[model samples]
Target: MTDTIIIGAGPYGLSLAAHLKAAGIDHQIIGEPMGAWRHYMPPGMMLRSEAFASSLQAPRSGFTVEDYCRLKGLAYSALGMALPLETFVDYGLWFQANLVGETQQADVLSLRRVDDEFQLLLTDGRALTARKVVIALGLKGFAQTPPPLQGLPARYASHSERYGNLEWASGKDIAIVGGGQSALGLSALLHELGARAHVLMREDLVVWHERPQGGRRLLARLKTPDAGLGRGWRSLFLSECPGLFHRLDPARRRLIMDHSYGASGAWWLHDRVVDKVRISHRTVVNSAAIENERVVLDVLSDGRQERVSADHVIAATGFRTDMRQHAFLSRELAEALSTQGGMPELNSHYETRVSGLYVIGPASAHSFGPVMRFVYGTKHASPTVARHLSGSLKADARQRAPARRPRAAAGASR
Candidate 1:
């Protein structure tokens, strides 16, 4: 049995592994590194966040974009402070190779609480037991495809998560929903790939924040517990004291969740994509029906209803937190697990109500505050969860000893 088993070797899982290894904890990290990001992200896309801000949590050996560019002899541009998605993936792989070498490239099929441990069943029919388990599965399984558009056929309708290659629909007329970053990014990508795209957003205009001036000084302030773009008491409340945020009444939490989703995209994205795409603001797609190889969308723009035809519709509607969405979780286990609002409830230490089980990343939002859903939250969660696991392992060791024959009994038997 291992001391701890981490599921999903993405940023959070890998960062936790680095921290656990640095603390001399005996653990195994499993699942594909950057699994969701690799599989779900659009090809040739760049990350919205800065490169320096994204790194594994290790004392000195963590992988960073700067290190990656230098090592690979690739020209590193400081433009926009963001790294290409491909570069970020390469850097992640490098980090996994050097810092988290014990990770297994396998999918976890199911998990069960067995006594004081977790019995993980892998797809290859291998069973592993662990004193503790951390679920770092990212936002892949939880992509929130809006329910209203469910009736449209798959050929004429798709979610932004299904966009692995925009090139597949070259020269096609596409309608994209949502005004958020993903919608804008998809619009830009589709346009670049020679597709005629129309972006329909309920908002009055495409909104985004300007990049802060200065260099590392500005970045340092942003990374602080209560400063930069993540300022305001709400941001601080979520980042610094997540437990308190978790304790807020359900109505208040819902209000907070709605308020938190208001933040928009990067300014550069507007310059690159929004300026080029045909943007229809204050517009909502009322309903969709198929009409001979085309999607007839009943759209309401500025209180006027009209029909628009497109070969495909892409809904950039964001994700929702519902434990029922996770297919790997058994129906019995899903029902047994406690929930807050619609999200899975977690303990102060990031563990679920199910003993010996823990969750992190987007799945931990209801417990660890709204920041748990963002990529940056990994910085705060990885170290804390690692410390908790380490302490638990040490305490468990003291409370339980290996089974051994008594000295008298051994001698007599021999």
Candidate 2:
């Protein structure tokens, strides 16, 4: 049995593994290296975050996005320059090579807490036990499509993560639903692909993110500090200190989390979206169904109801921390979890109510705050979890060891 098992090899998993290995912890990471980045995210897309914030945390400081770019002899920018999706994937692979090495590419069929250790069933028809398990599964199986489009078949509508290339929708009428970055990005991409596309947003006006500038004054920087979530005192606090959020009352925590991170298009996407793709604001999809070999959307917008017929519908509704949807956890284990709004209730050490079972990445956002959803959170989270685990393991070892006897009768006269 391994001392610890990491279920996913994304940024959080790799980061925690790096720390654990350096601390001499017995652990194994299983999953595709950079799997989500390569599979979920489409090509030609650039990260919304700045270069410095998109890196996986290492024990040392040399392995950053900027560092990767420099080593590759590519153009480097620490500020909010466009880091292509491919570049980030390659960097993640490189990080895996240098830090954690190749991960075991096996699917975890189910994870069950059997007494003290976890029984992990693997796709390769093997079962393994581990003292602890870390579910570092990033944004996989969490793409949510709205109710209206949920029932439609795959040929008609799909989530943004379902497609890697939009060329399949060429010569087709496509409708993208959402006002967020994904929606906007896909709209632009579809327009470039020579597809007829329209973006439907519930908001009247889309809030385009302002381009991040360099050489800011000290006062300005102090007021709205740079962070993964963007420039703001609240953002700065959440990014720098995630634990404080976990200490807040549940209601307050939920409120803050829900309100934070309003989504919009990248500043660079302004030109591509404007005058290129049609955007229908104040639009809400009431219902969707397959009609006449296509999907028909009954939408309400601007106090009027209208029918939108399209060859395909792309949903960019985003994800939630709903634990009930996690199919990997056994029924008994899933029922045992103490959750807050489907998010696992976690302690400061990222441990759930069940001892030795931990969760990081987006799953821990409710505990650690909005920053937990971003790759940047790994810097703080991985080290914190590693230190706690390492200390706990050593303490356990000490407890199990036979105590040494004191020198017999050193002071007694024989």
Candidate 3:
């Protein structure tokens, strides 16, 4: 049996693996390294977070995104620099090559508790047992679709999370729902790919944030400090003092997280989207139906109802971390854990109610606040989890030793 089994090879999983290995823990890292960024996102896409905040949290400083870019001969400076999605993926590949170099590329079909360990059934027909399991599935099982569009078949409607690129929808008439980065980003990408794409959003206008400038403003720092989350005291607190957020009442923490990062397009995307993609403002999708292999959306705007027809509808509503989406979890094991507010209830160290079964990344947001949902979160989360897990594993070994001692004494008496 291995000391631990990390179920994903994304930023969180890879970072934790480096920590665990450096701490001398026996563990196995599984899944395709950087699979989500490599497959789920389209090529032209850029990360929502700044480049500095988008790297894995390695044990040392050399594995940062800036370091990778410098070594690879890419623009390695400020956040305003246009960093392609491909560049980030290439950086992840580089990070993986140096840390957690070998990975088991199979999927975890199902997971269950066997005695005191987790029995992981893999797609490769291999069964591995581990003293602990870290569910770092990231956004894999969390993509959300609006209930109104649930009835429509895949040919008519789908989520933005379901695509590697929009090339398949080439020359198609598409209607994207929502006003956030995903919606605006996809709309721009689709239009550029020769598709007639339109946006349907309930917001009054499409909003965008100004890019961080090259030089620092000394006066701006007096009012608010810059942090991994962004430039503000609140962002600083959330990124550095996540433990305090975790201690607050769950409701208040939820409120802060919900209000902080309410979706807006990047300034870079504004030039690509404006005058190129049409936006139906203050609009809501009342219902969706598949008619003649097309998506017919009943939309409401300005107290008027209208039918919008498109060859396909993309719901960029984003992901929900509700525990029910964890289908790979065995029923008995899932039922044993506490999921009071759709998200799993985790302890201070990111451990779930089920002992030895830990969760991190977006899955730990409900417990650790918004920081856990971002790549920068790994800076705190990976080292914290690795430290706690190392201690617990040693304790477990000591406990088992007492029982073995009695057996040794019995053999000597014989």
| lDDT for position 200 in model 3 | 93
TM for candidate 1 is 0.88
- Model 1 — which ten-residue stretch has the worst lDDT? 224-233
Tens-digit lDDT string for candidate 2 (1-414): 898999999999999998888888999999998887887777788888788789999988788998999999989777758788899999989988998876789989999887768899889888889988898987777778898787688888888876686678778899999999889988888888889998989988989888898789999998888888788888888898888888898888889988988668888899899989999999999999888898889999778999998999989888877766779898877876746666798889999888888889998988889898889999889999998898877887787799999776877865
lDDT for 299 in candidate 2 is 95
Ranking by TM-score: 2, 3, 1
TM-score of every prediction relative to native: 0.88, 0.95, 0.95
User: Clashes in each model (backbone N, CA, C under 3 Å)?
Assistant: 0, 0, 0
The sequence of per-residue lDDT tens digits that candidate 1 reaches over residues 219-325 is 56556433312544556666566667777876887787777756267766767775688988889887888888898889999899988889999989888777766
Tens-digit per-residue lDDT, 49-113, candidate 3 = 88778888988879888998888787776577666889888888888888777999999889999
Evaluated at residue 364, the lDDT of candidate 2 is: 91
Q: Which pairs in model 1 have colliding backbones? A: none
